[model samples]
Target: MSRLAIAAAAGLAALALGTAGASAQTVVSKIKDRGYVVCSGSQGVPGLSRPDEQGVWRGFDTDICRAFAVAILGDREKIRFVPLNAAQRLPAVQTGEIDFLSRTSTITYSRDTAVRFVAITLYDNDGLLVRKASNITDKKQLDGLTVCLQGGGSLTEKAVLETEEEFGIEMKKVYFDATIQARDAYFAGRCDSYVTDGTAAAGQRATVAKNPAEHDIIVIGKGTEPNGVAIAYGDDQLFNVVRWTFNALLWAESKGITQANIDEKLASGDAEISRVLGQEAGFGKAIGLDDKWAYNVIKQVGNYAEIWDRNLGANSPLKVPRGMNALYRDGGVNFPFPWD
Candidate 1:
């Protein structure tokens, strides 16, 4: 063929490839077609995503996935949890193996640039779990110690490195593919310290430690990381569904709406509550969901506070305080957008 004809043929092939790629990127449509949203969770993080004795996944992170299912499929139970570790979480979402990642991963600059993080579901800081016999009261004490952490360059590793640099100290790092592996190695004395999110450290100690009282979870740094669900880049519709589902949880908490009170709140005279509960017409249609989307989430999954209290709060084994995860009304950072 002539050079000009060859160039034209290459352009047509490029157009076809672009069209095929775009068609393959359908996140929400695929979930709708499959009738369930597949969410990525940790292999096991007790208060975050571990299965109970009944083999049922239960945790704050688990509820986040359930909330997504309720928002999209109008049924909280319409979800399948794919167990992943820090190393496997992002790729699972990127490759469309999971709808969104909620395995206690945090938002970093690189991740934010590569994918879309919908909302900050939990506000946490890097923490270290050390044997109580060590009597290490401060995070800096962990400096120069070998630490066990999830490998494949997880944010926990990044946090540890950053903390070491900021404190003018050094640490020996041991890597594992999964959180369970890291915790096992820590318990087995592979490392002097185990580093991860504050709540996760607590959960690990609570669930996996031979004696929970034998270890202490300590904050290692000044900065708090906002953990959120991440999706493939540039799909605004699916992103909105995930983002607003989180907001709905926060908003419900702000309004004192709970699984028990959602029905009563639907009849509330407050205009904002009414609009968010789907008594007003624009919410569901605007988000490409049914009018009862938020209602279903609240009814089936409960609000953010309920999920927290149920999984990580005083009622749960973790017994973690709300801290920064609380709604703004309660002086926490979780302030959702106004529903107008």
Candidate 2:
């Protein structure tokens, strides 16, 4: 073969490889090109994620979606919510039916192997909610009682089993496919109690109870649930985008940057806050975004504390304590990564 012909063939092969590489887009780019994020959240779990009477979605999970939307698309409203039950959430994520799962899903070893759990947004625990009229103050008093759960294959169901084993008592179990179904059955007097994570149990009692005062949440086990956002595994760039976007929320909260004061923060004399707000330029560009990406997220969704206050804090119906969800310096598990 002629030298000219060989050189031409090599050039064409290089061009083809370059084109293919360019076409293999990241999740962030796909979301941007589609003009919105398709996020999967809970099916009307109040304080965690639910739509109001006005059809506006709001909650801790929804706020995470909004923060992600703002970080990637630069517009908080550039996101759509899809509600899924416990049985359906992981499948939807694996099949790409949703771009990201922001529901109150517990991160576990099995799930981590199947999908990437970016960061823990809320630390949770398994617990039971019983009717106050029953006077059930202790878990031992309810031994052998009927309990309604989403299903046995899920984390909540497993937690129930583990609790029974730990307490050395057997509780009769009834299973359902959706949280709403089990919750309805419990409300209708079909079961003695409903099993779920502590945060969700509080949310259910507050949002769905006809008489909120008639229910009491019985804490079963004592440990962190480490619930987090889930995305498809094997995409390092996309994982970093999510992990650090969440980290930015923690970082902003630690630095005292709130939605109301983001603009002021952008012009502050502090080098760290200025860099975080994108006054200095390396943070966003490293994550395949513009310099103001973190700024947009904070300005739109506020920081971790602000989100918690709006959705699950004292003013909300659930009124869940920050507990392990607080910043590390403030006695919680949230420790933001250094932007430097």
Candidate 3:
């Protein structure tokens, strides 16, 4: 072959290889081009996802999505928050309407088959929200009660069934299209109690009730419900980004890294911190992101513990106890997956 022809063939081969590599990360490439991430959340469930006085989405779930935003784009505010009902979440993820579903979604066999679960970010159980006037202080007192529930494939709906079977009682289920609707029903004296995830139950009692002291949230099952962040099935490359970003929050908290102290930690000589913070090249290049991906997440959005405190603990009105949501070493279920 002529020298010129040989050179042209080599150049074409290199271009083909580059295109193939980029195409492997379809969801990531698409989001990068669009310049923002579509993150799924709940509709006006305080302590999970709800608008503040300024209409900005703020809560633990909002922060979970925000962590991914900063990890991928280095901008936590570059998020298009799509509030999803129970039925809408899975389809939105499967059809590419959102990057990942970060609502308090339980990981069941059916759901895991439909979409890839990034990680169980919240550990909770079903709970009943009751008015103190009703004098029903225990789950055993819930017999034959008319309960407000968000049915139609929601994990909250599953709570109804589980509660009935476990307590040996029947509940008259009054269903709603969304969580806020059900909470409203209970507040209007339509149902005896409102049933949902324990975290959201506390949110309703704290925020939606006429007086926070007038209501109580009673956790239903003794077993834990693992609520995961889900993405479309079969997108392994995108999965890696979302999964590690979720883990990075947990990892940051485990290592005593906080938004306030991250800068100091970054300057430390610790080898693991350096690698995780992307002071070295491997973590970022492997995920097709900037070297400071984990740093961006912790610095911009704060770690998992910080998010919980701001949204559900002392900083927020809810002040919900961290039961199963605490770290594994702290007598709860969450364990941070190692960065190595």
CA lDDT, every model vs. true structure: 0.84, 0.85, 0.85
Give the per-residue lDDT of model 3 (tens digit) for 1-340. Answer: 9999999999999988976786666788888898999999788888998887898998888899888888878999899988888888889998999998988888988999999887888888788888888898667788888999887767677777877898898889998988789989989999998988888888878887879898877777556788888999766668888889988988898999999999899888899998899889667987788989999999999988899999998888888777778888998777788666
- TM-score of every candidate relative to the true structure: 0.88, 0.91, 0.91
> Which of 1 and 3 is ahead in TM-score?
3
Write out the backbone clash pairs for model 1. none
Q: How close is candidate 1 to the true structure, as a TM-score?
A: 0.88
Give per-residue CA lDDT, model 1, range 1-340, as digits (tens).
9999999999999998985676455677688899998988788888998788998888998999998898888887788989886667777878889888887878989888777788888999888888999888766777778898877777677788888878788889888877678888999998998988899888888888989999988777668888988998878778889888898888888888999988787786888787778877766976678888998899998888889988898888888998887776777877988665
Better of 1 and 3 by lDDT: 3
Q: Please give, for residues 1-340, the per-residue lDDT of candidate 2 as tens digits.
A: 8999999999999998975575467777788789999999787888988899998899999999888888888999888999898878888888889988999888888888888888888888887889887888666778889999887487777777777878788899998888778988998999999988888888888888898899988877545688889998766667878888998898888888898998887777888888777777566766777788888899889899999988999879889998888887778877888766
Worst 10 residues of 1 by lDDT: 19-28
Model 2: lowest-lDDT 10 consecutive positions: 18-27
Best by lDDT: 3
Clashing pairs in 2: none
Candidate 2 regions with alpha-carbon error over 4 angstroms: 1-24
Better of 2 and 3 by lDDT: 3
Better of 2 and 3 by TM-score: 2
In the order shown, the candidates' Cα RMSDs to the true structure are 6.3, 4.2, 4.6
